[model samples]
Structure formats: structure tokens, C-alpha cells
Target: MKINNYQNKRDILIVDDLPDNLRVLSEILIERNYQVRKAINGKTAIRAAQLSMPDLILLDIKMPEMDGYDVCKELKSNKKTAEIPIIFISALDDTIDKIKAFEVGGVDYVTKPFHVEEVLARIESQLTIQRQKKQLQKEIEQRKYTEEILHQSRAVLSSVLNSSLDGIAALQAIRDNSTGEIIDFRCLIVNPVIAKVFGKNKNDLVGKIGIRKIIDKIDNNLFNSLVKVVETGKSLSTDLYYQCDSLKYWFHFIAVKLGDGCSVTVKNITSRKETELELKKINLDLETFSRSVAHDLRNYINNINFAGNLLAEEINLDGSENEKELIDIINLSCDRTMSILEGITQLSQLKSEPIKPISFNLSPLVSEILNYLQNNEPRINIKFMIQDDVFVNADRKLLNIAIENLIKNAWKYTKKTDETIIEFGEIKSTEKLWQEKIKLIDISPLQFKQKSIYFIKDNGIGFNSVLEKELFTPFKKLHGDSDFDGTGIGLSIVRRIIELHDGVIWAESQLNQGAAFYFILATD
Candidate 1:
């Protein structure tokens, strides 16, 4: 049988061996605006139905090779065509035959020479029921998919909450009955880590009101902060110290409001607090020891200088040139020793001394120091290249000390040369150099307006650059006393003075090639 366009119509298949019976059913269904199909034999009907599944099937019980019962059985056995509603119309009208038809997955049974109206009614009823069954099936599958997604989400949330290192707990606020004001909080959920800190199992803490059991163990501040967060809906954080029996701990508590309750996280900070206190005590002791040592050594050096002065006066004038040279050496040694003691005393007091910053011209100060050095050493030829009106805001006395140390070191190192040149001038620093200096000192560069890069360059014999790291360390000498005379504390003092004024100092040099000491001071 030919098929018509069934796109907008429910399809119905009529199966029978008699062509007349098939024609009659198809005429009735096609007149009702349903796409109709016809199969003459049971095997052909099964094949056609499987190829294009129909909304309903009308089968004749007795057929050529395969009967309607066998056809229905075949269709029901296969998953694809099993749900198509089957109605049997056959001449075997016995009660047993009708019962057998339904037993083989037939929906309704009609007698042979059936009424066309009855057939149409039965077909409409079955189609309505099939649509309802499909809709219900779709709902069931969708509900199953939704339930699986919900299960996976819950598993992920559970894993994240349990895997946290900090102690975590969620609380529900308990309010007064009459006033509707929050009176206490009941624990809703708690991670295992928090339960361990309180010395209890996680299950035991759930649904508990008021943590009276562990109240004395932890500081009351933690509870108060949580209460405040719940009432005001504001977050709070603080450090708490806990001590119970032999156990002592420091805890940092953070609480944030959530709905009518709050969530809290706790971390132990005992080791960190202990380390800070220990370091504080060590620094205090070291400062006290340094002050005592510096005082005693200064007095001893003063006495030695006094004794040396007496020896120089008592020495005979008509002595060997070597004898006179020995006397000169003793006097020079005494002066150097006194200078070292003074440097130590100055360094020891740097921390205690308060900085009194004032605007002062640096050019005049450099000139003054150079003039004093010239008066002391008349034989050496000295030259300078100082910048005019180089102003700086720093402690006048400290700045003077730093400049004097730099110039004196330059003069001492260049003593062997016929003509010595010491240049004191300011150089413009690039943004890259300023940034690097800020990083070295670990301070904010944004606070500075402009930096004054001053350098004290000398045409003297400079040491190797490899020893630059140890140059500013106390008692760290690069050259021996026989080669260059110094106490090795001058540069250290200069560094300290510059640091006190929020400045940085460094040097660059090579063997036998002149050394230049550079310092950066903030102008604003």
C-alpha cells in the first residue's frame, strides 16, 4: 500500500491477509486525516512497522505464515517497536482467544466484521494513552539527570569544606522568644580540624548550643567577636592566646556574618609569637653589652694616649734618626687608636641619638673639611671639584662626620701620589638607578621627590671590588696597617649615619684605579 505525507498526522498501520479488510480500515483512518499504512501479511507488517514505527497498529489474528499473536510477540520482544499500541481484529471470538491476544501484548480485541465507528474510537483512545506515557517517561529521565548533577555538586562542596587546613565552623543564631534578639548560637556544621582543636569529635559538636565545655580553654575574646559579628552583620578578626593545663597556644580568629549567624576560621600562631619575643630579648641584651664594651675600651685608650704623650716629652733630642722615627710612630699610633675609639663611641650612640634634620648647604661643609685636611697635611697637593649650593636636609653633626670620614679616607689612600685629586659633586640619577637603590634598602621609592647622588671620587690606589660587601662592616679592613693606616670603622660609621637619614651609600673601585664612594640622599 502507498503511504501519504504523515508529517502533521499520527500514523496508523493496518495488517491483514484479506485486501478488502485492509482497504476498509485504511479508508476509515485516511478519512479521519491520519497517515495510514497497509501490510497484507504478518511478516510484511512486522517489517514495515519496524522500518517506520507507527503510533498505533491494528492486527488480524489469523494470517498466512505468521499470525497476529506471533507478530505481537515479536514486536513486544524488540525494544524499538514494543511500545506501539496493538489492537487485534480477528474471527476467533472465543473468550480463550481474546484472553490469549491480550496475553501476547495486545491492548484491545475487536470481533470480525467490526463497526467502523468502534474501530476509530479504539484507535483514538490508544493514541491518547501513548502520548501520555511518552510525556511521563520524558519527565522521569529528566528528573534522574537533575538528581545526578545535584549529587555531584554536594560531593564537591563536602570535599572543599573538609580539606581546609584552618579550623572552620558554621553557627546558627539562637534568639530570645519574646524579644527576638540573639541570645546564643548553635553549631550547625564543623570541619574535623576545628573539632580536633577543641578536643572533641566533629559529630559531637553539631547541634550543640553554647560551647561551655571548651569555654575556659579558649579566650573569651573569640566568643565575643563572633557574637558581635552575628548581631551586627560585620566581620571581625583578632589574635587570641589560649592556655589550659600544660597546653599553651596562640590562635588567630576570623569571623564573618552569614544570614542570621556567622562562620569562623581559627589558626594557631604559637610558634610565630614565641620567635618574635625571643628576638626582641636578644636584641636588647646585645645593645646593652655593646654600650658597656665601648665605654671600657674608650677609657683604656685614653690612658694609653696619656702615657704615650709623657714618653714623647721625656725622649732625648740627640738620638739616632731611627729613635726619632720610633717616637713619631708611637705618637701616630696613639692618634689612630684614639680615632678608632671615637668612631666606636659614635657608632654605639647612633641608635640612641635622635636625628635633627635642617636644610644646610653641603658645598661649604665639604670645603671646610678639605681645608682642615690641607692644614694637617701641608706637603700633599690636594684639589677639589665641589658643586655649588648643594643643599641637604639631615642632621648637621652626623652629616659632617660622614663627609669627614669619606674625605679623610681619600686623603690617606692618595698620600703616596705627587698630586692628589678629590672630587665632591652631585650627579643626576636616572629612574632605573633610583629604583634599584630603593629595592636594595627595601623601602618605598614613591615617598621620595628627587634624589641627590653625591660622589667622593679620588685618584688614589683603590682596593679590589670583590671586598665591597665587607667594606662597611665594623673592624673589616681590606689593607694591612703597614700599607694604609685605618681603624676599619670609618666607612661603617659613615654608612650608619647615612642610613639614619634615610639614605644609601655604596662604592665602585678596581685595583690601582681610582675608587668613588657614592651616596643618595632624598631632597624632599
Candidate 2:
């Protein structure tokens, strides 16, 4: 058997014991542009088909050594060539049972001395059917793959919806008959979270249209906004207040449109609202207390200062140096006490005021504070190292206070030192460097991070590093009143200001050496 021809043509193998029969069939197939293989016996036919599988096989039953029925059965049994259509060549009055030919995987059996037209027709018909089966099988496999992908996607979506912490719901808009205006929403799909929030079972909520109506009644704008989202395909996010008999609640919700429906997520914010109200009440009390302390205590201190001045002018203290010094001490006490009270009042006001950040150059602000300090204390000599063109996004009024307090502290602490120096600049850092400890190690070699880190370094009498953590705690101080003068509230106020701007501030200090403050703002 030979099958060397390789082209876009159908292949057929013809088997017979007679050389004439084999030659006749091969010529007829070749004339029809069919690649044909001739075999004189069953053994040669089976080997040829297996080696290079033909689309069809023609077998002769009365062959020597091996028969057509056995060859067809052998080819059918093998998985690779099993589907090749096999047609038996047999006589009408054959020794073998004709019914048994088909049972042995024969598609059709031809009579002895078969006609050329009849043999060609049988081969064409079986080849056509095989092509159709392959086409159908390919379509079926593609459909199965698509169906599996769809199933997996649905499963993942179901998992996300069910596991969400916030209440999740899918609602289809119910429109009016004439205007097509959405009057209400019908729950199409709801996750377990939605069921829990609505205080009902998930199964019960589906297909229900009244749940959203009850919720919409709590907030005047909720229904209208939901309808708008579905109609315009725009998203809506807002806070809603709901009150019922002996029940009050606050919820933050967002709605996004999906075709004629909307997907919504609701989060309970009742605790947050309650806390805000409580803070408001506390702020009111704090404001009143600050006013009373300012008015009542301020007048008493003013009277002491007045009386001390009058006594010093009225008395004749000739050779009475001790008496004059006592009077000076009383005057200084009154001034220091008033400054402390003013610090407390400023601290309270900052706590209550809202912060609004704006971009501005920082160098000028630092220079102004430094000039004010130097002008007031003309005898003191201090050097300032300020970075130019440094812009920061922070509340102007609040930042002024923070910078003033820090610079004032630097001035006070460095009074005894041989030379005073203060530097302000930006320190670029990466996320990993955010956790970098401020030790004796240099930081110039570190790579820049995504966010800008700023630092203020002062060559002043620094506090012990052991007390650094407590430095931001209210009313906590490291140095005593005889050594330094401060209310110990400035650092705490600075900490609060940093937190409000979504930033962090930290410092490293060594006693009698120096201190540096590092901070990062997260406005972006």
C-alpha cells in the first residue's frame, strides 16, 4: 500500500486479493482527485490506514491470509483509525453473513464486480457524513468551554456580593405608566449583608418593592437620587438620616447604575454621627470655660501688676536693694502667669477650629517668625537656615501658630549655648524609609520615597530621647520652669494639627545636643 500524496484531497484505502480489482478501484479514485492506497490483503490495508489514516476504507471479504471483516474490525478497534468509514466489498451470495459485516464496523457492503459509479457514490456519501460530524463536534466543544467560563464568573460575583461588609443590593426601577418616571425600586438581587441591614431574610427581600420605600421615607432626597442614578446612569453618594419610633440611625450609601437598574451599597454610620454630636457639645463647654478663665483670672492678675507698680513708685527704697528685687519678682510672676493662660486659650481655640489647607511658600513665613523673635530679643544672636521655594499645603493661620511656637522654643532653649542654629528643609523619602529610626546614622544616602518628608532641625538644648514619646502628650514637660519657660502644650497642638491634615510628625533628640522634627503630609 502507498500513500505518498499529501494535498487537500480525500484519502481512500481499497483492499482486495485480486490485482485487477485493486488496480481498477485506485484508477477510478485518482481520476476523481482522491488520494488512493491499494492493498491486496487485509494485513496490508490495516497497516496502510494506521500509518497514514485515510478518510475511508474499502475492504474485500474473500481475500487470502486475512479477510475484509477482520481488517475492518482491527481498524475500528484502534482509537486513531476507528472513525475512518469502512465499506466491505462482498458478493450477493457470499459465504460470510452480510448482516455480520455491518456488525464488524462496516458502513456499507458492495457487490462482487462492483460498478465504478456505485463505488464512488458510496465513498462520497460516507466522507460527507464524517465532515458534518467533525463540524458538529467542534461547535459542541466550543459551547462547553464558553459555558464553563460563564459559570466561574457568576460564582465569583456571587462570592464578592455575599462576603461584602457593607449591605449590597441590585434594584430595578419601577416606572410610571405614562411618563416613564421611576416611582420606586424592586429588589432584584440582594446579598446576605443587605438582608441583615433590612432586618429580613435574603429570600424574602427578592422581588419586594416596599423595602426601599420605607428607607426612602427617612431621607427626602434618597428616592429622587436613586431614580436619577438609574435614569441618567450617574453615581450618587450621600449620608441619610433615618428615625422611627424609639429608633434613630444614620447611613452612608452609594448607588451606581447598571442598565435600567442600580447597584447600591449602604454602610451604617450611626456611631460616627453620635460621636460628632458629642464632640460639638464638649466644644461648647470648652469655649465657655475658656471665656470665664480669661475674664475672671485676667483681671485679678492685672490688679496685682498695677499694685506692684504703684508700690515701687510710691516707696522710697534708699539702700533697700532686697525690697526692690522682691517687687521685680512679683511683676515677672504676673507676666509669666498671663502668658501661660493665653497659651491655654490659644490651644483650646485651635482644637475647635476647622482646618483648610492651601498651597503657599514656607520660607517667607519662617523668616517672618525669626525676624519677630530677633527684634524682640535684640541682644540674642541666632542664625537661620531656611530652604527657599518650599511650598506646603496647610492652613495659613494654624501653620503660623505651629511655626511660631517651634521657633520660639528654639530661641528659648538656645539662649545659653555659644551659637544657635535652626534649619528647615524638605527630606525626600520612600515608603520603607517612613519607618526609619532617627539614630546617629546619616540619612543623605537614602533614596527618595513617593511622598515628600520635611524636617526642622535646631542646634538647641534638646530634651532626653527617653521623654520623646511623652513630648506630644498634653501638659508633659522635660525641662523645669527655672531652666526654660513654656506651657508644654505647643508640641501637643502641633501633633493635633498634623493628624487633621492626614500627616505624621516625629522627632529625635539628645540631651544637651540638638533635636530634629520630621513630618510627612498625605494631602495627595
Candidate 3:
């Protein structure tokens, strides 16, 4: 994994009483791309290691100052150097000293005049084991992080559902038994906002068998949006303008797919909507009037200002009056519109903004995304193989978008599998090693040209290999929209985000098997 700097060579400390032994070991480790440090005796070894920690240590069993067993025990006692693995090398082949070497925290024991191959193999083994332990620890921490995010999200959702000003309802789709058509939605839960809007008791609506004629006048457009979300399991957010005999309002409707149905939130945005329209019309008419008329009207503003002072003073006398409520609403709407316009202006010019990159761990981020996906489909028992401590240097926001799209894509494709397994990890730096270890997908998409290749793999309904070239093309699809309900822009968006970080994405798959996506970012 790209947990740390993979380009950096491993460091090894060799301690021996004889200069010749240290020289020989140093050369061997250096040849294998390891940074080697030498100390002629135990005391010197301990001092050198305490000053600069090495990845692994080779210590002689017998020395003038102190034996290797004592040296190992002392090193293990120190918190900073405790994790460094030590392999004891000495002339003493006695089994008793070997047991003592292990008792004192020596990872392995090697006799004197050991074969070069055997010594190298033992050293590599110890280092590999140490790396694995660190990886496991990171994975455990990431799992905890995912659980915490899930718990916090559910809590916040509960709070919003219970206390939000918006009409909130939990619904279950009533489907046709034979053809699986969502005929209507049954209210599984409802809050006071929703109850008040429909003019029904909360208790009465809890088990209602259909979309409870919202406000006694449900529009066709609103009904269609609800059905579409439940059918396709997609989210919907729209500003809908509604008008009736007594009501003229705009509602912001948001529907998110929950289980077999969807949760809906209806926000009344009539005041803001009306203000926006009124201001736009006034600005248009004023500019036109300026061009048409001969008079440059400065006196009109004074007259309006004088009228405003009279209106404000009169309204302040009766706070419950209609004029007072209208003034309050207008003031609120103006302030909200200003803030919203500022945000919209900034967001619209996306290319003008430069990305801010930072180095961070990917394990927790991927875990959080996976947990969210699992919650959406609580019935799916997906086995996740998330590599630990995977670190990346990129714009966190852009990278988050990339990771979420990729993971959500994987989650969607794997929905049909009887036994689902999704993996988020990286290919090893060596191609030969990772090729053999890449089992997350049925077919391989493993490319280890870089030091490491980040990957997200899934055992899902894979796409056609012939469409590989179009995988990241905007709106290009390997599958029909009828079969998989998506605009086919998800992968394209992921590619754009990855490209912004100076990276490339690739995919490979066999039909009906599985697919794997690989990406590698350029290092600074």
C-alpha cells in the first residue's frame, strides 16, 4: 500500500563484536536496497539505535559489553524502539541461548557462519511481518472510525426527521406482487410538519396505505418524483412551483432512497422564491424605464424612502399585523438570497478555483463511504477488504468526490451478487507479486507500473470488455439505462477528478465476472 513513502529504502542496523561481520552484513543489506548502520558491540548498538531508529536489527549473541539477549530486552523496554524487529546472530548454536534470545524479544535466532541466503530470507521475513502488523493496526482504527461516522450520521438524521421545519416522512413502497411495480407508498413514519401540511393527525398517517394527498392536492409531478426515486433507488432534489385556489408557493422537495421506499423532506421556500422574482422584475423594469424616459428620476427614490419610514413605524406598532409579517419575510428573504447568490457565483466558476492538496490516510475515508452504502442497502452483507493506512497526497475535496463515485459505483454493480465482496486497496510495487495476490476481482486489472496503484474492486455483474475504451467517456454506457439506472457520467466525473490530481484511471473486466479500477497519482 501507499501507506508511507514507498520510494524510501528500508533501514537495517547490524551489531557484531567483529568488524568483519558488520562489514559483510552491511554490504549484503545495502546491495538489497536497504540502508545499513553498524555497531561493533551491544552498548554501541543500543546507543546508535536510540539516536536513529532502524527498520530491522541484526545483533550478535555474545559481546564484551553486553550479550544480545540483554540488548534486545533493553531495546524492547523503550517505547520508541520497541517495535523494531531483531534477529540474533552468534557462534553459540546452543538451544538454551536460542530460547533466551526469543524470551528477550528477539524475533529470530541465526547461528554463526549462516548461509547468506538464509540470513537474507530471515531478515526479509521479519520486516514483512512487522509491516503487516502496522497495516492491521491501521485497519482496526479505520473500522472504528467508520462505525463512529455511521452512528453520528444516524443520530443527526433522527434529529432532523423529528424536529425539522420541513415536512418529513418515512415511506415504504407498496409494490405489485407479480410485476414489482410501485403502486403507491405507505407512510411508515411522519413528523408534525408533514402531518400539518396534509391536515391529518400524525397517529392517523403513520400506517396510511398511500401517499396521503399532500395538502389535499397532490400534483402529478410530485407523485411521479416519489415513484421514480423508489423505483430506481436514486435521490431527487428539486425546486417545484405549486399553485392552488388559495395557495401560491414553491416547495423544495428532497427524496432519498431508504429501503424499499424513500424518505422525503418538503421545505417551504415561497418567501425566498417570491422575493427573487419580485427583485428581478423590478430591476428589469427600472433599467427599461431609465432608457425610455427623458427624466433621470432622483426624486422618486426620496419619495419611496419617505414612504418606507412611515410603513416601518406603522408596522412596528402592531407586530401581529400582516404588514409586519410581510416586512419580516421580505428582510429574511433578501438576506438569504444575498448569501445564496454569493455561494452560487463562487461554485459556478469551478475552473477558476485551484485545488488544495494535502497528505492524509484513505482507510477511514473509504470506510466511511462503504458504511454509508451499506446503510442504504441494509440487507446486503458485503465483505469489505479495505487495505490499512493507505495514504495519498491530493486535494481532499476532489479526492473525496473521486473516491465516493468509485465506491458507490462498485456498490451499485455488486447489488445483484449473492455473496458480495468489495475491496479498496492498492497493488504492490512489484507487478509479479501483486498479480498473484489480486483476487478481489474475477478478472485482473492490476497494473503496478508505479510504486503502487490504488484500486477499488468488486465481485459484481461486470461490463463488456469491448466497451473498455468508453468507460470514462461522459454519458457512455456499457450497459443499458433500463438495466442499470444511471446517466453514465459517474465514471467520467471520477476521471476528471483524478486528472486534476495528475493521475490516470483504468478498468478491465470480463462479462458476468467482475471488474477492477486502478488509479495512480503523480508524486510531488
- Predictions in order: lDDT: 0.83, 0.81, 0.78
Over 22-111, each residue of candidate 1 has an lDDT whose tens digit, in order, gives: 898888888999989999988898899999999999999888789999999999999999999999999897999999999999999999
Q: lDDT: which is higher, 1 or 3?
A: 1
lDDT score, candidate 2, position 249 = 81
Q: TM per model? A: 0.52, 0.71, 0.40
lDDT for position 403 in model 3: 91
Instruction: Output the lDDT of residue 85, model 2.
Output: 90
lDDT of 2 by residue, 144-188 (tens): 999999999889988988888888898988888999888788899
The window of 10 residues in a row where model 1 has the poorest summed lDDT is 434-443
Say which candidate scores most in lDDT. 1
lDDT of 3 by residue, 385-460 (tens): 9999998888888789789989988888888888789899966567675554444335334332344678899999
**Model 2: residues with Cα > 4 Å off, grouped in runs:** 1-56, 60-84, 87-135, 138-165, 171-187, 192-215, 223-238, 244-246, 256-262, 269-331, 380-382, 427-450, 508-513
**2 against 3, candidate with superior TM-score:** 2
Q: Would you list the clashing residue pairs of candidate 1?
A: none
